[model samples]
Target chain A: MKKEHFQENCYVSGHTACAGCGQSMAVRIVMNTAGKDTIASNATGCLEVFSSKAPESAFGVPWIHSLFENSAAVASGVETALVHQGKKEGINVIAQAGDGGTADIGLQALSGMLERGHDVLFVCYDNEAYMNTGIQRSGSTPFSASTTTSPSGKHSTGNPRPKKPMVEICAAHHIPYSATSSIANPKDIEIKVKKALKIKGPKYLQIHVPCPLGWRSDPSQSIDVAKKAVETGLYPIVEYEYGKLTKSRKISSPKPVSEYLKLQGRFRHLLKDAKALAEVQQVADKNIEYYGLK
Target chain B: MAQAAKLCRPGVIAAYPITPQTHIVENLSQFIADGELDAKSVNVESEHSAASCVLGSQAAGVRSFTCSSSQGLILMSEVLFCIAGMRLPVMLVCANRALSAPINIWNDQQDSIAVRDAGWIQLYAENNQEAVDLIIASHKIAEDPKVMLPAMVCVDGFILTHGMEVVDIPEQKDVDEFLPPYNPPYKLDPKNPMSFGLLGTPDVYLETRYAIQKTLGDVLKMIPTVGKEYQDKFGRDSLRLIEEYKTDDAETILIAMGSVCGTIKDVVDSQRKQGKKVGLLKIVSYRPFPKQAIKKALDSAKNIGVIDKDISLGSDGALYSEVKSVISSDKKISGFIAGLGGRDIKAKTVEEIINLSEKEENSCRFIDLNKNILWEEFKTI
Candidate 1:
């Protein structure tokens, strides 16, 4: 099918998401690219609760909402079922969850799905925190980022650890494709998603999505923040295939983590703490040096 | 005459072996190996995979089955909700066993009870016969277009699963007649392909859940019809939901589920001769929780007590809480926690519960509490 045909009106119009919700836009683009021949398994998170309220649907394609975890497992089941029915050809299975859902709650299921090598694409829209549940800190919540559960105060710092390296974890499974993308660059996300679809075995794509509500940033700044995340080398856009890092976005001079952190209130506390700021910079430098983005 | 049922009914049989539940997978594997069943038998590494395997298989528009026990069932907990929410009519045989800490491998309802709200329809079996029959019925009920939700059949761990009775296994032809070939309304077919799960915004998420709720509500209605059809095919009449035992004139009734119901029935019969107005209400279908039948069964009893083989930690028994919710309007039912951790729930224990219910005082008591243990006494010393 033509890419334009795949793009024709898949995600339902009139969603209840906040203005410039990165996850909403990411799902819309992904679903459109997935086309009509694709089945989606969504885990419980901002994307699921916001789009699938009772009596209404933001999905024009057939859809299922499992739990906070196990979206990949559910997607695997769908793939297996199709294979059993002699319908595995051309049909694509996509499992989508947010950072909280994938990095923390869904890690095992996602690992299992990738390890099993099912013909499916698993996407982790990394919004950092558990945005659907009042911004609780998740495993994907970055270091020095304040959340309801991991608040920054005199006694305690914000989330004191770097986010779990999910793409690396996916890579460890030796799947056919694993990538990290950002909503800041739709073309990049679309290219990676399209590339993932072509790979025979399981594919994983971690999409950096800025959450206004959880990040305590302006809604309209979603894409901009996501872009700054890439530019700052805090969230490098990279892809791996066959257990090897195949590609990464080039950045001649990476911006400082402070530039990315300065825009959000969740990271506002980190500005005052010189030690925490240094630690955050260390994380960014590590990502930039590790992915060779600079 | 006992006849063999076709194993071909299930398009996919995904399972992980646990005590008591080993037989279901063993038998299914045998059938598949022997070519008696034309299905894929996925021996999953974990119960989680087993449940997930069935979920994916079901979404592909095929009949699926899985089996698990206490820890195994608990491990499958997360996927259970997914199977139900995805509206896939997958069937599972949960061989009931005690939850751990002390680690008992015997019979109890704690495992299935932990997953009470996982959105799957749950059924309890009183005997090996019911275990086999209810499994077939579960497939029918789950696969029903109106009831496109996963279903679980709970058989007492060693009580029924290990205890092999002279079960009149239905003829494959009869079972086929009773349960037609499962053709899913929507499947992942390339020709008429569709998405199984999609991203939903808030404007539509509740609607998806409502649809699941509506389907489950519909399953409650469809279960009876499926059970009746099975009964017509096989000469055994199964109570599609709750089964009442001599409860008509009883002033006090003991409510229980799983294989314990049989033991409770025997106890009730012996007590009835002693002039005790005691009866037994065996909850067969735990989910789509037979609210009306439960209310009717316990409505007339002067004192009602629910014997729970499962505990909900700080709260009362899960089954007891559900029973209380059902009988909230008219009854003041007592909750009894007993026979946990695969502990032998002797007939005397059930009889004691019934006797306790008869009293105006001591209504809700832990039946088998270790009286020798006293936290306050220990702390003072």
Candidate 2:
């Protein structure tokens, strides 16, 4: 689809999102695709708090602000209502949550909604930490990433655990649709979203959205950083259906893990420590071999 | 005419059966099944789904109903706040029962008392007639445009809920005349689409809560008007908020809620015949607290004994503390914990408490204290 054909006017715009925030860009692009017929349920996070401050909402479409953990549940209720009333044809229900909201607090409700098979699209805009609450490490935060809560110090290393494989969790539910997309590739996101809309049951799409504010990178380098995550096999774009992995975007000449790590200050400490760097490379290789990205 | 006035209104009802509270759902289900009530009946899997079903249906601009008790209420607690916060005006019939520790199923106000801050308007019934009538009145009050909050008619489990009595169930025409079709401010209309519960930042979060608070606070004013309007048609003038029994010439009063009020009233009548200066004050509205009416009822009493079926843990009984907060500092108030976990709160126990209040020595006591199985003396057991 042509970029101009995508709705020029988005539901959320002219907000105080930091310059080149991947979440803000993804919201704009996704809402544009979702159009006016969408009722967006946003978890309490940066996107929700920044855009839809009451009396002055950036959204043109119907939007709900729900608790951080229950955006999916709230959207399920909304979808159930719409379906019961026989008004589900044109109206689309979309639940958008950040990494912390989706991967941590909102996981149970999300799982419940998916298991219940509500006809709603849940979008996890993964910026990798609780950015709205000041760069705290979340379940989606990568290993060796230096977040405020998981800071590297004399006594401790950065985040010690690997990022949770959310796509596998969604796939385990035997959901009709689950995909990993990225703001770095808007076309992939747009295609996955359109494909998800055609499915009859709960659909999940986790978009790799880099946050310059939280990732400690140059604001302009957000998209580049996101792309490197894909190219280095740290974040492979994959899709699944009926409990089976169906498609994956393969990377030609996959870069070493160091290429992705050196760009962000969160991973800067790992460069000086060979042990930490080796562990990071092991995670990258595991993701590459698991997704069959190469 | 009274039979016509008590007919079921047109709407959708989804419910589940819980112990002690099953009768309310059973009666409503029968009403729908018999073709007397023009409503859709959904037999949900659990109280949580029952709440969700009604909330969803109500959001679609349809009036809906559900009922539950104790553990069931707690199971549906999360969705209760959702329905109220969304301003859906859904009405529920709550057969108040004791919460689980030992898991005994019996009559008590503990169930509804635990959910006191859930933003739903709670109206307690003293008898079967009030149980049926209050359910009708709650629909009217909740659906009022000025007070678009969820309402629960709390009937004592097994006591008023299961106990059969002569209730004048109104006819369909009277119900239609009294309760109007639900026309929500913003529903899930495809043509005129709007968000129901949108996220708000610090810029507008406080205002949303304030709006709900103000609406709830102002809803008390509409209760009397709505109550009076119902009475004009039904010929029963039920108290809109709190009911006082023999409170006029009493030196000592027992303040309680739910069906225990009936037990206390019985105790009060026999005590009054013997020239005892004891009275009973029954709290009808638990949410919004009925603070002003509570203060007025206990204003002249020398000693106020509060009987609570619900414990607040770390503190005394929940209602006792709420009542104490409303009364003047100089007033002597006693907090007694009774009927917890569905333990029997007999009339004799209430009568003994009332008599004890007259002595002016022991202020508070736990009724039916099992001394043999005491925790302090249980090491050798």
Candidate 3:
């Protein structure tokens, strides 16, 4: 179990994910970081549907998919079983879910897993909406973004609410470590995962993974869009320990929110509505001011 | 039920707090705290997570248990189907209670009866002692290699779960001899990395369900052998598909499940003293339905009456409908809906059902209905 051993490709190729699928990229990074002695409990979303379809699997480690909203609970059970079997010394348990599963439906189980202090790491792939169900608006969907359920219309704009502060909510559980990473920064994700796994208690890491199908971005620009999201201070990459902010990624030469929103068709309608566009910019401004990212 | 599970030496147990089932989990936690049990007890946030937690532990190759009632069981219904579909031998004790809309926290068979088709072995207990016996036997039966399906032991909410009873709990060493450590055929292991609960494409989905259906067919034969083995070790004739009382030369037999059979047996004894040729047929296993065993049990009787604590709403009782599905068309069969929502099913009610079956043919009737409520609703209609 050296770090170099974990760098080996545990998430091998040959799957059905989209060409620039951010979730599958993040999963490959995660599984490689977790190494071969790890077990994954996957939620029912794009990652599960694409990675393990029937007799085919992209994972080299043991993996299980129970339901859409019980990944964290299932991971907790796996960790407890390892302890009961007296084999919890060198294994890592990780539960991963999509944005909708994390911020909305699976929140309770995640909270229970954290509050009970299970030795597991929970990862949330923040793709902004329910992309598997054709881009329905979710709690984590950004403000003024067009989704199937929150399409722009005469009576209303697109999604009216801002993206939920899921990392803050998870940090409020007083877990040992909580951090936010992005698919744009693979090294940062690996470092944060290694750091979180060393704490010996429940840890939370939410990775900002762009969805090309749902966000309607260019297939090859997933990393570019994710980098712009972090550069614009819309998706802050920060770390917390014991409910206090320990580190925040400083945005050098901060970009405007429009630079990030223009790359995705979901926010194209906001470019015409100045007021809505300003509201979305204000969201980025508030995050930069609060997290001291600039 | 908690004591029985503890005796079985489960590796992991998880449960959330709901009425009637609350005490079972509490007792289990106490066992863990007192060092009497070496297990991990997860105090989950909801019944959904409770069921999911055990499903995970059991899938990881360990014996696991969970308990719930009423709305809690309803919340766990989604994961219950997953546990069975994945073919995990997870054990659950359902303290049966009524469903909501009126929100009654009382005794009924609706909760467990509602999820009978979730692909778990459904066992109904006649009393607290039988509930314990069923819990122990469920693990052995569900963990069998040929029949690796989840099992739920159903007990009446307040009547069996809340009531105190003198039960002959088996010793831990004896239970150890009865149920060995669960050796899962497949598991989430690093040494042998295999995936579980994968998506079933159209080419493979039908065969997966057909496999469970075929396994349950094997379970129907395995349950009685397990019950006989349990009796040989425990000295009690419990854990059978169905129990017969004085049905040999009887002309009328009243059929029911759960604790109401006690009242029916008492009524049968008094009716037999009066030379009425009355008998009782108690159903224990409800999921497999035991069509052959039930049909054979009602052979000598001329009139068959089925008493159900839960109804199917538009149709007759769930038990009555199943009984009618099996027996021949010529039999004088009747259905009686009784003891719903913790309503008492006294000896008099059983006597009324026995007398009603003698004259009624192909009728489903409701016992102990208030005439005033019926008249008021009639006028409104």
Chain A TM-scores, all candidates?
0.96, 0.96, 0.96
Docking class of 3: high
Q: Against the true two-chain complex, what DockQ does each candidate achieve? A: 0.30, 0.23, 0.81
Error of 3 at B69 (Å): 0.7
- Local error of candidate 3 at residue A24 (angstroms): 0.4
| Chain B TM, every candidate | 0.93, 0.93, 0.97
Rank the candidate models, highest lDDT first: 3, 1, 2
Over the stretch B1-381, how does candidate 1's per-residue lDDT look in tens digits? 011223337777778778877877787788778887777776555788788778877877888778889999999898887677768888887888988877889888888988988888888888978877887767777777777788788888887777868887777777777778998787655445354555555766788788887877777787777778778788776647888898998888889888888889999899899988889898888888888888888767878888888877778888888888877545547888887766678887887787677665332467776656757665343
User: Any runs in candidate 3 off by more than 4 Å, and if so which?
Assistant: A1-8, B379-381
For model 2 chain B, give the 10-residue run with minimal summed lDDT: B1-10
> What are the lDDT scores of the predictions, listed in order?
0.80, 0.79, 0.90
Q: How high a TM-score does candidate 2 get?
A: 0.87
Per-residue alpha-carbon lDDT of model 3 for B242-349, expressed as tens digits? 999999888899899999998889888988899999899999989777999999988898999999888999888999999989998778899998888888898888
Best-performing candidate as measured by TM-score: 3
